[model samples]
Target: MNSNYHISSFCKIKNNEVSLNGSVIYNNENNNFSAFIKAAYKSLETNYAKFFKMDALSKLAFLAADVLLKNEHLNPEEENNIAIVFSNKASSIDTDRKHQQSIQNKEDYYPSPAVFVYTLPNICIGEISIKYKLFSENSFFIFDAFNAQHLLDNTNSLLSTDKTKKVLCGWVELDGDDYEAFLYLVTNKGSIIHNKQNIVKLYNT
Candidate 1:
């Protein structure tokens, strides 16, 4: 297999702003996560109704993936060749708290199926897969911090094999008001070499 894989493109979303390839493409400092993401969705001008219903974590990942893959071309025939490897410090705790609170109050014990559905961190990955129709392998890892080396290893393992031609990997962490998402598309085509150093550098940028 090919030894040299590159990060074709990367997108960062945080602090009410969205950046592509380390450049700020969208910004709205006045709103919180919910409003900011809704504005970002409107900016895309693509109608995906389910976006509004998704929990905070899902929305964050979905928007980042949308920005990363919006202009990139993918073969529909080879949909199964694309893989998603995502990691986060907090695994859907934002929604987990909501689910927990919903049932904790005995008098107002109203368990919400919608909120319960997104309690799994991997659900964000599933949302992205459904949008792109990618049927390949997908994994969500929970790390104490941004483990770039681990991410690099996971990505390399997939690309090193013939099973996957491209992998969308990154750190997407969201906890309450504090949130950050960095997603990159990795493949054999691109200028930036996909290595541990570069991954950490790009993620910081």
Candidate 2:
């Protein structure tokens, strides 16, 4: 059993609040999702130019992953040792709605290539990978709900096979104005045990 793996850090973003390892790092109750997320981005002090162009789902995922990896020092030799495993219930429906609206009216149909690009949820993974230079195996699963067992299974398989040294796995769901992001980094050293039960409990917390 790959029971030695642990959760080094976790991040939760919901209700216009962002918390890292159980402590609130950013929160804004007065603004909507767009303004709130942008505020959070500014708080991180990251200057990724492309961030502004990403759809809401990508922006949310990017911000959540950024909170975890911001302070991480990547070794050139081990830069490819990190993997990302993310799941979401909505599955890019937020962006799909935008793309659908752009062409739904036949009389004035105008499909946008920019909006079409983000119709798939996995693009957020690409955004994170590009920013952090993580080239390990990455996957995005869509389930009716958050499936921690599946995440555990895949993460354990990757680690046990020595495919990567760490796994960034979590549930990032966004449906219109309702959204939640729970991301955690799993590695050999941490304060929390990496298991199905603990994964579920941490997500709830």
Candidate 3:
């Protein structure tokens, strides 16, 4: 896919949350995974019920996507040309840990199907699509680190084929004692350059 769409803007939430051309959404001192999850959820919406219902990975994706979309003022339905391409390192290991723990505990040796369903990395894409009603091509890739060249090449191929007019691509990784999500909204209409250098510069800035 040779996509011409440029990333108009991006947002990231990590140990110390950061945003491109926007304010930091949240900065929590608790340093607990649950605390980070709660702060991230609050960054997305005021409804706590909805927040608690989402799995850990889903919550992370939602918060990152929500912040990016809000900053870009993007409506997936209106555009009707948006897609999501997410990559991660841990690949839902956190969920897997919990599931394994459930079965390991003889007293509570029952694995909840709900929790097991989120073991796949793509679940985050599903959650984001459902939340934004984006019925476009979505994919989840597992990598060792932030592979900017892979992202650029893959996105370019996807866009070149006219399969998707816009793309939301990023690295959303989570694991024990670590969590980070960086997302950018790329569109065919913008001045932003689409290359490894620009991608690195964007993230660095």
**Per-prediction backbone clash count:** 0, 0, 10
Local lDDT at 17 for model 1? 93
Candidate ranking under TM-score, highest first, comes to 2, 1, 3
Write the residue-wise lDDT of candidate 1 on 79-134 in tens digits: 54689999998899999999999899657767889889999999999888887888
* Per-model TM values vs. the true structure: 0.93, 0.94, 0.87
Model 2 misplacement above 4 A:
75-78, 105-110
lDDT of each: 0.87, 0.90, 0.76
- Give the per-residue lDDT digits (tens) of candidate 3, residues 105-158: 757667878888888989888777765678788899988888888888878877
Best by TM-score: 2
Sorted on lDDT, best first, the list reads 2, 1, 3
Top candidate, metric lDDT:
2
lDDT of 2: 0.90
Error of 3 at 95 (Å): 0.6
Q: Regarding TM-score, does 1 or 3 come out ahead?
A: 1
Off by over 4 Å in 1: 1-3, 75-80, 106-110
Scored against the true structure, residue 117 in model 1 reaches a CA lDDT of: 96
lDDT of 2 by residue, 1-205 (tens): 5779999999999998999999999888844788888888898776789999999999999999988887466653445568999998889999999898889855676789899999999999999898888999999999999999999999999999999999999999998878899999999998898999999999988
